[model samples]
Target: MPFTVQYAVPMTCEDCTKSIKKALDNVEGVENVDFDLEKKLVTIRGESAPSQIVSAMRGIGRDAIVRGSGRPNSAAVCILENAQGKTRGLVRFIEDEEHQIIIDCTVAPTTPQAQQVSIHASGDMSQGAMSTGEKLYTLGMTSKFGDVFSLITRQSLPLMNTIGRSVVVGPPSGPTTESLAGVIARSAGLWENDKVVCSCTGMTLWEERKVATTV
Candidate 1:
């Protein structure tokens, strides 16, 4: 199913937009692309993976940050981190209008082997994955590609119920203290987030992006 995903791109001229459109045209599964030059936002309607879209944008020497996806109140995100607070991966959940949940996950520096990914009952992360409660739902296993473990699958999990839970990635046996875990949080829907500056930090989008990428 086709869903909308929005990105914040730095564009200074119509030529930049043309470049982006031209690059995205080669990405499979992309249905359409729309741009807001003044806002430097690009909204894409497609079935393409978010990572693929970002890579496409980067192919033209432009960086893209995903601003929103899916529909209002139907999307959520989790940043899996180890006990040391080092980010290990990111997971995005999008429930389409048909109620089919799209799970997109990416983990780096993982062994070139399959590993279990699931949601736990508790969101507590004081002790990392070990502290998260019982496993509630097993999304699936991730397949390794190069140095990253990536998985893009469609399931039937409800988005709302997963909020406040914890998603964990670990060995096939089960989660451990060394496993990666993160609390699920609600994310903005397509076009729901349009602020150029973060009110809390008074930092521009690019500034925030700098901090995020550094981390």
Candidate 2:
């Protein structure tokens, strides 16, 4: 899985340029390299570790660092299905870095109530129903067909871990009997929720936005 990364480096001569070029070329996962003299920027397209790229530049005695990234270089998606017509969801995994992945999730809300959605070990919803496989991550959806929720996992794991897996949307089994209690339960620290999820992500819920979109 390769993505693009740009870097800033200080080079005064051809020797400096060549040295930096050669250094980055030798990196284990770097696929291609192009240097812009005017911008002093280097764009690399590969699976090279960001740290490794910076280290390579430093090895040439040139102080270099990353420039800009607008999106993930690599990605994967899951097609979520629900039988009760409660909601449908789509979860995307965006590249955070070489070692980590960011979750970009969208769901179509059918029921006004919040549902517990997540990435599971398998996509088969028929066997034991929605809760069939091991629940990998708990997801939150406030509005159905609109805004996307962003969650960052600390694992820095590869997307290969999700290739054949499925995303499930269902009711949350919570300790407290309340609306969206499953979500609150997750925040309260139950199940395997904290291991993969690092923190609370900025996302929109129906209640917050209904004020603006309401008739």
Candidate 3:
């Protein structure tokens, strides 16, 4: 999905900005990157997934949050840890009674040690919807279908969203042009007249409805 990355990089001079651009520009899947020292922001327009961005930033000892006018799925709990088994931070995706997605990020001393992690968990409850508790169970119980931890996070670590009849169309599997259109539509909440102004990478067709409305 389209996202803006803001980080506290020490870009106090033009040379620093150029250096950042050089590093970020070389990252695979990154399209364009702009750094603003005054705002302490590094805004990036790209299809690169969050994990890729995070990995790149962390490699250079930088931190970033990707948000923007067009975001597709909500990323699930991110457990950043050190070799000492310390949990550096946790970001959770929760849904309330209203079916709206709530995202919470927390800093902790250590990452929770678990048998596994399932990124494809939901927090919202609705008709035919699953609960976060259920997701937790799946993460802990389901091991045959695939490795939940890797499967859910292999892409961009996704958190389950709504679970009702989708207003938009979706493909059976894999990524397609139609799939991208669907995600763009949902994220923007485009109606009959609304159209997708742009498309972002790492977004699924299911998210088109949300983006359509919110953007």
Q: Please, what are the lDDT tens digits per residue for candidate 2 over residues 11-113?
A: 5567777888788778898898877765466667787666577667757676553443334334555444444322344444545445455444444444566
| Tens digits of per-residue lDDT for model 1, 1-215 | 78787777999899999999999989999999999988889988888866688778868878676666657787788988888898778887777666767677767654556778999999999999998989988988887543467666667888899999999998867887778899999987666768767889998765654443233
* CA lDDT, every model vs. true structure: 0.79, 0.48, 0.33
TM-score of every candidate: 0.73, 0.39, 0.40
Candidate 3 residue-wise lDDT, 126-148, digit = tens: 21122222332222211121111
Residue-level lDDT for 64 in candidate 3: 42
Best by lDDT: 1
Candidate 1 CA-lDDT value: 0.79
Q: Which stretches of candidate 3 lie over 4 Å from their true place?
A: 1-10, 69-88, 92-132, 136-215
**How big is the positional error of residue 207 in model 2, measured in Å on the Cα after superposition?**
24
Q: Backbone clashes in each candidate structure, one number apiece?
A: 0, 4, 21
| TM-score order of candidates, top first | 1, 3, 2
Best by TM-score: 1
Model 1 worst lDDT run, 10 consecutive residues: 206-215
